[model samples]
Target: MTNPPSLLLVLSTCLHLLQWILDKLRITRLAQRILLHVLAAGPIPQHVAIVMDGNRRYARGKGKMVQEGHGDGYMALRRVLEICLRLNIQCVSVYAFAIDNFKRSPDEVDALMHLAENKLLELCSHGNLLQEYGVRLNVVGRLSLFPENVQVAVRKAEQLTKSNNRSILNVCMPYSSRDEMTTAVEGCIREALAEDDYFTESITEDTINSHLMSVQRGSPPVDILIRTSGVKRLSDFMLWQCCENTQLHFSKTYWPDFGLFDFVPIILEWQRSVWFRRHDVLFRS
Candidate 1:
């Protein structure tokens, strides 16, 4: 006859199973608690921007289709957005697609456009995550450049979330830094021409900044710019907003592989850099 398992052994096995369940379900909450504690100790970036790079490369490495990689990147984006909401970050901007990307093959560009349209529509759907989090969505780019259907979807998403004040999510698609600057300049010139004192109202930094895409939504300049996939370059992302004071974090992990835990060290590093800058310790004569 087989002996029954001891009570202590059974209790230990049950405890381990319970721990595994909590780890799978509440891991994000644990990370949020740690991040909150860190925020209490130091300053948190008011505006965080991401140059979500390496989706295609990540997919290729895994022997998957490029579109599949983009899908994974979208999933990673969703997770990061949740983290931002939990951390109470005021604004978060993502480089979804750029104007130069239109030069790609027709099929690829079409796929990307379709993806954007679907995502925008999903955000505008009833009881979407944006509504739950009170996050206002802003699509900043030349809307006319996109397909009519995409334009309509983008407008719908923006309009639906326009009143939410908990946070701002900026999605830059078909966007170019150079074009944004030119547009700002043109807007400033138009404003100057409208005024009686055209010569007196010179185009200044503030004038250009006021006309920038994000300014219309009242988003502040980006304080931290993170790029995944080991890329160090900005790739024409948020050139004006990520000013001299913005801290840059380059991660080796691909965007699809980025997770909530990945952000903890980045925030800690930002705090360290801010502390050094404030104390005038990092600069050398």
Candidate 2:
């Protein structure tokens, strides 16, 4: 009681705290509405692709190891998968490890490999919740480079959920869009030669796309590509397919900090944009 803050100081402090509380409440309400509407309207994405970024930066910010950030990212992904199921999303693709990531320090690369190995093993033993939801698991990208054990686990998970049709979850490991395109070209060349067609003449955009690694069984084109960590670059993920009016949602938050609730607002924003784009023909007038 001997000393009191100036009136201006006290008012400013109270105002700041009040504003913080209001912001938190508003965000909470928005998240709740987003979830409810997503479930009720079911305007879910046919295909959703994600670029998980910022693990190292997040770790640095928290004074933690990069490995810990990656571990946290893995757990966050599990939560998002559940959200995808609840939203009735038909296909979800996650960019796990890119071919360019191999350029990182040996210790970091080792940590990533270890994480993949452990996750694969766990998926093999426990299985995904996809079955109960009729979701199928698919692994895309260059799998020949993975360790023998990891490959086996990947194949096992794919086989276990091969017949399910509720949704498709595609995990891209060691993926490169250019490499994927080249591989598709190779496949087309083989198919053309098999039919006695000229390999040189048979390669076309459509031919190559037909052979690219994707949902062989009615996989929908990606409608939205979400990248975390404020990174504007696509990093060679779905490079050829995303050029035409595909919506992009960027988050400053690191991948590890993302959760089911965080995605709700993003989805809502995407939907609103889509609606406007679709009706722009009339609305612009």
**lDDT (Cα atoms) of all candidates against the true structure:** 0.82, 0.76
lDDT of 2: 0.76
TM-score against native, each model = 0.84, 0.82
RMSD, every candidate, angstroms: 11.0, 10.2
Residue pairs whose backbone atoms clash in candidate 2? none
Residue 167 lDDT (model 1): 93
Q: How far in Å is the alpha carbon of 160 misplaced in model 1?
A: 1.0
* Poorest stretch of ten by lDDT in candidate 1: 2-11
Q: Which stretches of candidate 2 lie over 4 Å from their true place?
A: 1-23, 26-34, 37-42, 124-128, 199-201, 281-285
Model 2 vs. true fold: TM? 0.82
Which residue pairs collide, candidate 1?
A: none
lDDT of 1 by residue, 1-285 (tens): 422335334534544454454346645566566746655455678899999999999999999999999989988998898777777789999999999999999988988988999988787678977998999999988888999999989988889998999999999888988888899999999888888547755988998999998877778989999999998999988999987889889999999999865676676567656655654542342
Q: Count the backbone clashes (under 3 Å) in each candidate.
A: 0, 0
Error of 2 at 27 (Å): 8.6
